[model samples]
Target: MIKRILLVTRGCAPDEFVPAWRAAMGAAVTAPPDVRPSRVTAGIVLDEVTPEPRHDAVGQEWFDDEEHLSRYESWLASPASAAVDELFGRAVERDATDIVVTGEHVLRGAPWFERRWRDGGEGLKHMALATRAAGLTQAEFFDRWRNRAGLVGAVPIPEVARGQAYLQNHPLPKAAGDWPYDAVNEVYFDDLDDLRERIAWFAENLAGNEDDLVRESWFVAVREEVLWPEATSAGEGLLPGRPGGRGTS
Candidate 1:
């Protein structure tokens, strides 16, 4: 599938932000240049995570293939884009938001909306983004990126090796435009403490691995909400509070 990840920060209170964000997406699914995503997931950034000094939430949407992706991109750049932006502009810190189209590789469990990240939701999510190494092409970078994943280190990079959920997103050279990052790695944890432990483990054991596969990295934590295709059967649990609200459960 063709996936697009949106990193953004809240601009208002949770009450206002959640609803607005949901409404915008509800309309986005069927509106405009006739593009519709098969899946949509929203992640509310956790303050405890000390995000990359910018975005707080991560959003994901998936389409069928490159053709659909290209049409969606064209729609995003057209004058009609204003109407699209205005739909949920007030819900987030617009200027700080970033978007990228990628090819998603699911490396772990499914994404769910069972708990509020703050209230100890199903799991807190960590997103590690990076660029391909200086001398390697995207192909070579992706090939060697997981080399250390099976190494015999005591403190393994849980996010890379094992986790509640892991998604390796590679930014398409043409689809992602002039973006600096080439990959967005997502992993889920039990809580803040678990997140810290895993992060520390990576620093002590796997930081050096990046030197050969990636250029730099940025991390963020978020509480997610499964907005579309509501959990019905695949996920563990559904959002239990406000209709569009996440974590309230």
Candidate 2:
């Protein structure tokens, strides 16, 4: 499981920005060890400046469990948190126009839809993306999928401690002719440590499971507090160059 996911703000990041970001990342790495921090998943900084800032910071962290995530959140709420606050706070105060931050246990379901699409169905292709948000627990989700659908695949992130497991459908062919639909089930964990244990267990146990399930996936663990703001359709609030589009540079 990912412990802390940090979403730093950067509008026009070039190769030069990596060193600065790395320095900021080091701040997180140095936080007090009682947090029992493990791994951090740093996403490439995305640029989308609006008139006013709005969009949650996006990043991933793998922790051992739900308890760890909760403990990390406490430091975030406490004013005595750590130098991380000072480090990020100074950076944002000097560079960010505006910023907002929040944290929560997350469930991610990413099922690929592969296969040829029929000619006229191109316009409705976006509908296939709906499954990425399904929130399902471990036992029920996997059992249902295994018995009903003959699908064979592995869990996406097996490193997290407490989370649901199941296979996502990836439709192949890609054109308009094949039926395409994907499935997702996300079960939240208490913290990063819990996630780590679950992932390890899944990896070891997967080998002995039936052949029609995912047995070769590797789980990743990450931990790090983050920064972000509210998000709307076009970038932050609206689409630039459109009738009602609104956002920053």
Q: Judged by lDDT against the true structure, how good is candidate 2?
A: 0.34
For 1-249, candidate 1 gives per-residue lDDT tens digits of 689888876777867776666655544454343455666676777766553445767788888898887777777677755555675677778787788888887764554322322232234677778777799987887777655443423334444334566667877777335765778877776567777666666657666655767677777766666565554443432232222433333
* Among all candidates shown, the one with the greatest TM-score: 1
Per-model C-alpha lDDT, please?
A: 0.64, 0.34
Scored against the true structure, residue 117 in model 2 reaches a CA lDDT of 12
* Model 2 ranges with Cα > 4 A deviation: 11-16, 45-58, 90-249
Check candidate 1 and list the clashing pairs.
116-247
Q: Estimate each model's TM-score.
A: 0.74, 0.33
Give the Å shift of residue 23 in candidate 1. Answer: 3.5
